[model samples]
Target: MLTRTEGIVLRTQKYGEADLIVTYLTSDRGIIKAFAKSPRKTKSRFGSSMEPLTHSKISLWGKEQASLPKITQSDIINSFHQVRDDFHDFISVSKLVEMLMALSPENIPNKRLFTFFLNILHTVKASEQGSKDVLHLITQIRLLATIGYAPRLKGCGRCGGKGLNFYPASGTILCSKCAGTPVGEGKSFVRIHDNTVRFYTHSIEWPIHISNRLKPQQVILSELSTLLDKHLTYLLSKKLQSSEFLAGVRG
Candidate 1:
């Protein structure tokens, strides 16, 4: 069957000598792995559309029960090349792509998530005066929310109260009164400022467009990042490799 969809290129790998195995987050389809024949040679048709972070309109040949579809055509909708050129931009984009690739399951249609990803690529390119770190954190928090793992920020997870403390290991945001309650495998906790709590609450309530410019202080950003890092690690049962890459890129 011939399938047409527009998707963001999550990553690509060389398949044999001249082809690529491309992973994409599509508008209609959740995730797809397509094989592009001979995209590496001189004057090959795929060009740079297969590069990571490129959003492309793609055509694929789907086979019944196949591991990956064959790519018949690809057109660059927005290469998003600028996002990769700046170190700051690249770090943020890499984190978004890698997290999405890791947690998003295959072939499950999620239009909201797909549109959010596209908007972010555009936002990162258009941003002039903003905290890329804050933007990156917002993106991560939003994805976690969409996937039903968002931290409970408004009230305690164990009890209903407005005063909350962050517990990373059990993935709960507990009220001050309930915060000391022991959780299994008690993991470390990060000190979250009032601003960080507000940031976390706002992210859960607002859309990305509204939350894009919320430049929290560097201290708050660091605290929230540490909190979410622990939360995500606990949920995924592993550290994110893209985070390591992001640290290296930022430094």
Candidate 2:
């Protein structure tokens, strides 16, 4: 069967000599892998629609049981040329796509994740003052929320106290009193600064439209990155290679 959907190209790789294997995050089908014939050739039908970070409308045909679907037609909806023009923005967006491809499950319908990815791309492309660190932090927080690993930022997860601190290992907030206590076997709480706590609390409550209003301090960004790293390691059992690469690039 042939089907049409809106999608963002996540990544592409050469297949054989001239063909391409493209992975995309689609509106209806989550993550889909499709074969694009002769995408590298000058006269190829797929054109730039197969390029990473390209948003497009795609038509694919394949058997229901086929692992790799074949793209029959594609039209570029947005090329995000401005982002591509800058090396920093280009790498940041590429890392975002790599993270999504690694973390998101195959063939699962997650509209929130899809929207988050689209919004971040748009932000990166449209921003006059670009900060890749800010974009990376936003993506981390939203990815956690989308995948059901979002940390609690309200009352304490243990004692129900209003004053909260994040425990990254467990993805919960603990009160000052509760922070001293051991959460589980061999697990201890990390002290969260007031600003860091406030940052997480505000981020969780604010709508995506107003998220830009919350400017996280550098200390808060570092803490959040540490928190995400610990939690992701525990959950995914693997370190994000792109994060290391991004850090090196920024340095």
Candidate 3:
């Protein structure tokens, strides 16, 4: 079968000395692994357009029922090379793609998530210097929400009261009244700033390109990173490698 899909190049791996196996997050189909003939060599034909983070319209042929398809043609819609060129942007974009590869399932269509990711990539590509870590945190939180792991940010988890505390393990927010109860054995609760909660909850609704406009304080960014890191690492069961690079550069 022949298929045309709009997708972003999530990542690619080398194959058989000269070929490339590419993974794409498509608008119509979920995730597809398609082989590109001789994409690696200098004069191959499928040029730099298949590089990670490039949004492209791809033409592929082969069946979807059993075996993966071969990408007969590809054209870059948005090269997004800016993120790759700048070290600062690379840290965040790599982590974004890494998380998507780890979390997103194959052969499932998630058009909304796809669009959200593209918007953020555009923002990352255009962002000027000013704590890119803030954008990374906001993106992670929003990505979690997009995939249905959103933490409770408004009202109490137990009593429906406002001005709550966040529990990373339970992925919920609770009122000061309910904050006294055991969130989990050995789990301690602290009063995270109301502003942080507000920002976190609002992050999901914030237009992706505009996410970097509201800057959280450096201390708040640190706190959010620690808490979110713990929660996401626990859920993912593996520490994200791109985080090491991000932290090293920022530090």
Model number with the top lDDT: 1
- Candidate 1 lDDT over residue span 92-140, tens digit each: 7787677677777788889988887888788778766556667778878
User: Residue 245's C-alpha lDDT in candidate 1?
Assistant: 78
Alpha-carbon RMSD of each model: 6.1, 6.5, 6.8
Report the alpha-carbon TM-score of model 1 versus the true structure. 0.85
**What tens digits encode model 2's per-residue C-alpha lDDT throughout 1-251?**
99888889888889999888998899988888889888788854367777778889999899864789898899988877777788888876775666577677778767777777888788777665645566657766776677666777667888778754566666677766776666453354455677886787666667655677778888888887777666666555444566577679999
C-alpha lDDT score of every prediction, in listed order? 0.78, 0.74, 0.76
C-alpha lDDT of candidate 1 relative to the true structure: 0.78
Poorly placed runs, candidate 2 (over 4 Å): 43-45, 130-132, 155-166, 174-189, 238-251
- TM-score for predicted model 2 compared with the true structure: 0.79
Off by over 4 Å in 3: 43-45, 162-164, 174-191, 238-251
**Of the candidates numbered 1 and 3, which has the greater TM-score value?**
1
By TM-score, rank the candidates, best first. 1, 3, 2
Best by TM-score: 1
Clashing pairs in 1: none
lDDT of 3 by residue, 18-85 (tens): 88888888888877788888877885336687888889999889976535788888888898888888
Order of all candidates by lDDT, from best down to worst?
1, 3, 2
lDDT of 3: 0.76
